[model samples]
Target: MKKAAPVKESGLGMMPANSNSWNIETHEQFLLSELLPLVIGYAKGNRHPSSAAALASFITLSTVLQSEGFTRNSLIASIDASRMDIHNAPEVLQ
Candidate 1:
């Protein structure tokens, strides 16, 4: 049998500076998912849009992402921005 090639570990030794790596609670993810649609849908509502729930969700997610030793603020910001992208996409709801 042929020997398997050695796997390289280059670039795997670096840790993110602000890592807050942690796992988000299931309840938090669930709440975020639920709040997302409502957030996008309420853009034109008579009642003003409140980001309390979404912000809380992002903060939780950010903590989890950081705990995992990943870039956190960017991820959270991307997620927030994606919400708007999702709303704008014609096929998003379909």
Candidate 2:
């Protein structure tokens, strides 16, 4: 039988040279730093509805993920896998 592939470790891939560890504070800081810029850019692009809806969804998912102790990498991987599965599925399944 063929062996299964090893799973990748989750969370942010790697820390910056200056950063020591990944913790709650680091997660919050990263979220704020990254998301604020995205929000601003979306707003500037006049995609208010899309930006607001996405931000709301992101906030909800972030809260749920935090409560469930999920890492960003795992979340992204899961979403990507789901999208691929859907895309490759037959029309009846979709």
Candidate 3:
């Protein structure tokens, strides 16, 4: 029987390998520096209560993504997709 080859790591869908231990301070800094500003800007541009709620959700999701070693681009894409979904919802649902 032929043995399967070992999976090589690449940037696509693969979490980055971290040599250092997890640091809450660093994580907080990342949220403040990167994620929070985006959320805040979204909320300001949207100017709706639901937008504020979505910002909170984005923060929570970002924290999860950070813990999972996901990249910033992933978080940005997620937020953009969520915004699109909200804006594209049926009028009856709004």
State the lDDT of candidate 1 residue by residue for 1-94, as single tens digits. Answer: 6743322233323544443232234346654776676664564363555576556556766665565566756575556655775546445221
- Please, what are the lDDT tens digits per residue for candidate 2 over residues 1-94? 6743322233233324445443335566676888666767677688576668577768776756655568887666656655776657545323
- Per-model C-alpha lDDT, please? 0.52, 0.59, 0.59
Pairs that collide in candidate 1 are 20-66, 20-67, 21-66, 21-67, 21-68, 22-67
Q: Please, what are the lDDT tens digits per residue for candidate 3 over residues 19-93? A: 442433447777889876777776777885656766577676676567567788866665565476655744422
lDDT of 3: 0.59
- Judging by TM-score, tell me the better candidate of 1 and 3: 3
lDDT of 2 at 68: 55
Compare the candidates by TM-score and give the number of the best one. Answer: 3
What's the best-to-worst order under lDDT? Answer: 3, 2, 1
